[model samples]
Target: MAGTRRIVVIGAGGAGLAAALEAGRAGADVLLLEAAEQVGGATARAGGVVYASDTPVQKARGVQDSVDELINYYMTVSRHELEPRLLRASAEGTRQVIGWLEDLGITWNPDRLYIAGLEHKPRGHMPTGDTRGLGPAGGAMIVAALLTAVERADNVEIRTGTRCTSLLTGEDQVVVGVRTETGEEIPADAVILATGGFGAGTEMLRKYWPDAVRHGDWHWYLGPDTNIGDGVRMGLAAGGELRGRGGTLLETPNFGRLNDAFTPPWLIYVNKHGHRFVDETDTYCVMPHLIGRQPEGRCWAVFDDAALQKVADGGYVDPYGLGVDLESNWTAAMLRRQIEAGVVTSGATLAELAARTGIAAAGLEATAEQWNADVAGGRDTVFEKQGTLAPVSTAPFYAVELRPAIIGITFAGLRIDHEARVLDTAGRPIPGLFAGGEVVGGLDADVYAGGGTSIGNALVFGRTAARTATGGAA
Candidate 1:
């Protein structure tokens, strides 16, 4: 609490980068430590969409969205579990975050498009142009921009391949700094943990929540292998309490489609009952919640020649025309392998497929018949599934088995106060220890909005934490 404050930020992901940049801008001597060789945890691999209400991007597009409406939408989706103060801060500060990014030379596209399920007005901001040339995920552009800003700022040191093993506590029980794997202790006046969540930590997932283990079959997309809940463990050891229970998990189709990358635009998803459970085009945030309600927390993608053709026409298929056919992708040999491993089942007829997959043959046939009929009638009766421009009546139906893949960025972590300080068991802020991003939970308890909840909250809280830690206006 003295002259030229020193700060240590653990993790080089989006939240960590944002926090470090803000603190450095505030004139704090900052050290950014990353466990992996590269920066950007899940953020680098994300779709690069930031949900910011009343942003200049939205204004440029003439979209009508306000902080009050954003708060209302969050409350409606969060089901009142999210703290009102935190929601207000996130809503109000999002504009500033966007502005700061723009000032840092990150360009945003002013396109207003609405995903069907979310209740908010169109206010999603995406990065301009195609970022595919940068990397597998468009997050490369975001991380590159932030890192560029960090480099230009004074008094900021970014050290890669340095792991923060533990927190350094002083006699007064305040976190002083962190001890790295090299047995070096970096000193600081304040410490921030932004190491993301427990997606790739299968062992931790089993230890904490054993029920989640059943869906372990679908952990094919291992995001940021280093994000093993180290931050969560460190915070808990420092006496921080975790919040947000009963969160959801999701299962996407096998990465076999998008050149073995985790691209979307799935053809169809079927449960263990061999029945289509959710609308494939639903928001990604809500899809996990829907998947949790199904049996075994698992599902499969069923598509055929016509549906694949439709995918090709809609540009959902590979744009480069990689010559990687889905038939080749979902071959009989591959299906046999999956079936032998108990991951998938196949058949020539719908009834046969249903029998092999252990689904009620009559029910599956009726579902398919009704679905085809709905396609013919241009209306879905049960799920009211929009975007039914293709039908699933082709022969030799293909089913690729899937289980819920828990991406890193847990909806549960340390509880924090309005100032972004970690809350104690008795609900008091722990001095000198601040947290944001997925490290601080309760933002997505019962409801999830799609546009930009994760990135928006990360930027908002990162800035707020910097302001609070440095005694600046938040």
Candidate 2:
């Protein structure tokens, strides 16, 4: 034990667990630390979709994809803000990472689908299982598989409920170990930080990513509450450089929480001014930006009892087929509960509905009348929304006020290179220090590309960090 290489990995999420397993398999003395009682962090709550191009699965499905195309698409998505080396590494390593997960006994869903937010061709590989409320299922399934593999690794030891408070560095600025919250100093030969983002820390969010906080209210994060920037603090204290400091993946539905990327086409979304904006059925990524540009980053879904009844009957049409299936996604019972809680307000008339929801009565009445006319004409003349249309008629109209929510990935943390080595202010890697997962940013530097991008980044770079730290091929 004394002579063996000791590699300590902080956080037990997708990236940390993957790194620990890789290092353990490579015969390194690996120790995984987690602050929470559970092993899965935000990854457990994710949609479990991983993006990989030119995989064997693609060949089987008759889909032609190339790493070159992937790199081109990714560069466009990042707006050329990504490091060329890391971007290429991520794109090229995707198939390998997916194969690695398969070797670990994780089964991918048979359907190879194209996700909308990617702004590219279909390459998302979803794990097989039930998805989150509205979209790609089986994040928990992936977590379970990785956890099983980690448990079977002979050299890997996982210690949960142990929070890493700081990084232990030598006088030469090389990370040597981590300090636990309980005042225990565990020395190691190398350290990997994968402790996720600061979505839950209002103070940290205000200090580092203040733009997300609008009028003192940060948007809700759907990730694990445990993600509070512990790794960012430890890495920064050890002279790690921060990258993509102000980027985030936010999902704010104008209506109910289907948890999927589904926005009902039957309803009209209006800003505080009671005016419709955006093509309602646009991708979640596009919808949120349009909503965030509003006065208070808030919007409302206005519909009537007729549309509500159609929704309750599970017969409403989703033109783009982007969201969850109507029959299986949500229930009228859920809406009734929200209505009882006053989060979903209703009234008999547009004027009364505006009064209850604090919208301008004149604007609300006019928008509703015009929308009804547009529906009757089978055209969304204002937004050019090409799909089936419905009017907000009938008594007992309703309004569901919505704010932004984030769960996919937080994009503000320590910067790392293609090999997953954490860097300092001078752009040199801190010796023996590496990072991956959501803890290391720059992939989703500004706008998010798709659902699986974060998970792909975590798995691909987690293995990279582990292999390099263990003196194996990176």
Candidate 3:
């Protein structure tokens, strides 16, 4: 422990930053290398929410959430495809992970918000107030906080714009350091790969995540353009096995497509066959799975004046409103813009709207009649869309087309053990090497918990990897 324990952390994303900060705090000499000009990979574009069970915020809110419940939720959501040991470690260490963040001067907002349509107790936490941590338009608050901690750590050295091209292996094929793109080898006693997933790599995404790639809808929302699965490839080359090829991918209405990638509100989501498939209020996690199950792996969101008024009334748009200019906007204005721009079509009557949208006019009329009747009768028949304060029967209806919009975070990657070590084909840990965050694929295989499983697990296992790398108790 007294000697210099050189640890090289590749990729200065959330997991890399968390790992470097934890290792440096543990008195290990750390060097954090980032390939891009700035840090905060996908986190820079994230909503800064972290899912943790039984956190201090939850306790303050009198919410009864235990580690057992957390583990149960994870296993149930993922259908036990994840390693039981890793889930146990993540659940058992949730409190410590949150405590560690607090100790590192990261503040968590106490106001607990329920994720759209998830059945879990409230465990969603974020930084307080209007200070959205980092990146564009106050979206990356957690990244900003974590970057501050990483910069202030005396034992940590951060180097940006330095791409790690290959792993430096020594005798017995153990990773000793990393080789940069410029051919400079940064030696280390241990290495941790947190370079994220291949969401941006069109070739890899098309090959692996074909559903997301086929529709040209995936890989639209992301921060780090350089996160092209370097870590995943490097780990596999070094004898790591991959998993989670089939995971969830969200297909929300691209309201932002009208506004230059800024998310919009008041769009009606429909499947490829021009019909509402699943509950629009479902969690983003399951939405992708639902969308993927649809024909052509695509969906659309129809909007009109009535729907816009509903959005303006502060209904289902609260979650996405923060990132886009939806409120203080008019549906007529959007319709005019879309019609002029040739992106959307409109009509004066429901029959005209049905003709333009290729939906059966009789079915559309029947659906609207039934929906309005249900609203009046207090029950829906077709989709069972409860709490319908408004119906889509207004004149001059508008419709904005939508495909699956993948927000960079892929639910797939390499398989790893509880110690954060990548597993081989035989399910054994790869010696002297470790991975966490999106690099470890099986953590959220079949399904994902709504709130912030990505960021939470990234922090959890980053710290765990640090402990394991330092030969300390994990």
Top TM-score prediction, candidate number: 3
RMSD of each: 4.2, 3.9, 3.5
Least well predicted 10-residue stretch by lDDT in candidate 3: 257-266
Error of 2 at 277 (Å): 1.9
TM-score-sorted candidate list, best first: 3, 2, 1
Q: Higher-TM-score candidate among 1 and 2?
A: 2
Q: Estimate TM-scores for all models.
A: 0.87, 0.88, 0.89
Compared with the true structure, all predictions reach lDDT values of 0.70, 0.77, 0.69
* Per-residue C-alpha lDDT of model 3 across residues 1-474, encoded as one tens digit per residue: 468789999888788888898888788999999889888887666665677787787788778889888888888877777778888888777666677767655666555445422654877666432334345422355566677787888889999999888898888778888999999998888999888877777777777777666655423645467877889888888888878874445553344422122234224456534566765655666666777676766555565566655544332223432443322223445445556776676778867877887766775566566656765677556655544445667776766555555554776688888888877888887766888788778887656666567788888888888878877777
Tens-digit lDDT track for model 1 on 1-474? 359999888888778888999999898999999899988877776655677788777888778778998888888887787899888888888777787777766777665334423764766666543332434444556677788888898789999999888899997678888999889998888998888776667776776545455644545333578877788889988888988753444454453432222223335666766577777766656776676778876666766546644443322333112222223333335445555675655568878777776666776777677777877888767667665445668866656655555453466788887778888888987778898777778777654566456777777787778777877887
Ranking by lDDT: 2, 1, 3
Candidate 1 is scored at a TM of 0.87
Which of candidates 1 and 2 reaches a greater lDDT? 2
